[model samples]
Target: MKVAVIGTGYVGLTTAVSLAMNGHQVIGVDLDEAKIVKLRQGISPIYEPGVEGALNQVLNSGALSFTTKLAEAQDADVFFVCVGTPEAADGTADLRYVYSAVAAIEGMQQAAPKRRIVVIKSTVPVGTGDQVAELLSGCPELTVASNPEFLREGSALADALAPSRIVIGAGDPGTSEVVEELYKAVDAPRVVTTRANAELIKYASNAFLATRISFMNELSRLSAALGTDIVTIANGMGLDSRIGPEFLRAGVGYGGSCFPKDTIALLQLAAQNGISLGILEQVRTVNATQPVWFLEQLQPFVPDCRGKRIAVLGLAFKPDTDDIREAPSLAILQALEEKGAAVYAYDPIAADAVRQKFPNVSYTKTAEEAVQGAHAALLITEWKQCVELPWEQLYESMAQPVLLDGRNAWPAQIVKQAGFHYVGVGKS
Candidate 1:
């Protein structure tokens, strides 16, 4: 089947690349002319791991192409809407981008009446598929289906090619079958259901995972007061088959493109439906405060951070990606600046994004330069370079030799042996 993917973002690019590699002719559409130009040159705009190579392969095979106009892919059999639905000011998802994507395709559907099947691969609130169908009610041939993507930022290509599960949500059974046929090449279990169920599944999955992380974070706090090791507690708890090890790692907080927005949007969605999700509300609260918890830990030790230089080891939300959206490093850096501390930050790929946010922040080329001459250092994101820094040289470079492991990336014993005061979350 010929596939047209709207939006050249992470989800769309990965989906287009994966389908093209599977021998489908795919045209990835985006408004950004520069991004389209780069894609045409076999350059991936997104920095997902192992994706650029795959993109080049598909481009070389003449199975994949890109365009800046939606009209270019109007004749395709299937159109996947992968635009972003960022969080609105009122905590709901801003659907303007989604509306625009649908509106552009609605014209094409108007021409032929039953030209193509529109599959929504964006994460949206429940019943959004119905809304799209209603928007293009004039086109009786256009079948709208909800096929929310579950691709992670760094490992997007892997997730797209080998998804854990595939979901097809449509009002008509035929629409569901049509969308499912596009993914017959992908070997994953399929869930065909009502539109609302499929939409809710995407948000609910992220909400539950966020809840588990906050649950462990809450316990990590209690474990600290009782001199109990949270790592061991998580391990013992995960040993039970009912409670898996995923999302059990206690850290600063959950962030990135999904959790923070999805949790709040879910809360707003529940309230709109006259329902209250108390546990999820608490999950959002706990996750928001995790950054401040670092400040609470800092004051007792530093006493006064005025004029002090602090090295921030990482800037991205997680390792292996350049995305800094809702990163804990942002909150940590802002708090440090508020406390009159000079911040020096480093991340292999994410520094450029962080530099725009904090123009005055000392963005260094290497991790060693970031830690050098700093009063103390806080390990924010768990990059491999951060976990395996030359400890002896790092100790010699620091002004105070104080280390705060925010992600608990380093073993306390090793940092102690390197002659630096080490502090970690829920560590006794």
Candidate 2:
């Protein structure tokens, strides 16, 4: 298959590279000349494990290329619209980028009529694919399909290469078959359905995952009150087949490009449709207040945050990714600063990016530096470097050996034996 992936952001670039690696000739198209130049030189703009290496490998094999214009990939059998649909002020998905990419594909199809599937890999609302299909109805050779991506941020490349499922949603079987042929080599379950169902699958998956995290977080508050361990509770619950553990761990909250935005978008979508998702509404509430609740745990140790040096470990939303979009650390940091705490933060890869948004928060070169002489250290993200450390050294260096495990990642028993007061989400 000759595929053209439009908008080389995380999703687009990962899709392009993965498709090329799967024995397809792919050309990535984006209007950003600078980004295209970098991609042409086999340099990936975003950070994901093994993506750049795989990109260079495919580029060298002549399986992949990058271009600034869609006409360059005019003969492509599939045009994947992998653009971003950021959240609008009204809490709906902003489809400007998706629409722009679809319009460009329409222009290409009109100029040189040929059989092509305009695959919408971008996450949009339910009827987005139908709207796009109508836009290209004049082009008899062009068809639209909804093939939503389920790539996790840290392991996006791996997820793309071997996804859990391949969803192909189109108005007709011919369009779906054409899109299905592109992923025939990939080993995954196939869900051939209507465009609306496919779109809802993406949103529902994220919304449900967010709900799970928030449910556990809300339960952690109760667990904390009863002096019960949320970690143990999660493990016990995970033993049940129906409640298998995933997103059950209580933490400050979930943040990233997906969960926060998608939950809001889904809620807004439900409202527009005259439906009220009460449980999901509470999910967002629990998540929004989780950081503040976690901070309350700090008061028992640090009576006054004024003039205290607080070490904040992990700034990115999660480990192995530098994306801080809607990251809970931002809220935690703002609250800390408001309390007059001199915040010191450290993240192996995300510090530089976070430094831009928070100029006052001191970024350390290493986790050790962030904890040095700090009154309390908060584990916001469970990066290996942030979680696993020389306990003795950190204990000796800190002015007061107090540990707040926001993610319940640290070994509470070991840290307590090391002469430091440890506080986990629902563990003492």
- For each candidate, give its TM-score against the true structure: 0.98, 0.99
**Model 2 CA deviation exceeding 4 Å by range:** none
lDDT of 2 by residue, 1-428 (tens): 89999989999999999999998999999999999999999899988999999999999999999999789999899999999999999999999999888888888777888899999999999999999889888988888899999999999999998999999899999999888888888999999999999999999999999999999999999999999989999999999999998889999999999998998999999999999999999999999999999999999899999999999999999998989999999999999999999999999989888899889999998999999999999999999999999999999999999999999999888999999999999773
Q: Given candidate 1, what's the lDDT at residue 258? A: 96
Candidate 2 structure lDDT: 0.94
In the range 145-262, model 1's lDDT, one tens digit per residue, is 9998888888989998899999999989888888888887889999999888999999999999999999988888887789888888888989899998888988899889999999
Q: Roughly what TM-score does model 1 have, to 2 decimal places? A: 0.98
Task: Output the number of the TM-score-best candidate.
Answer: 2
lDDT (CA) per prediction: 0.89, 0.94
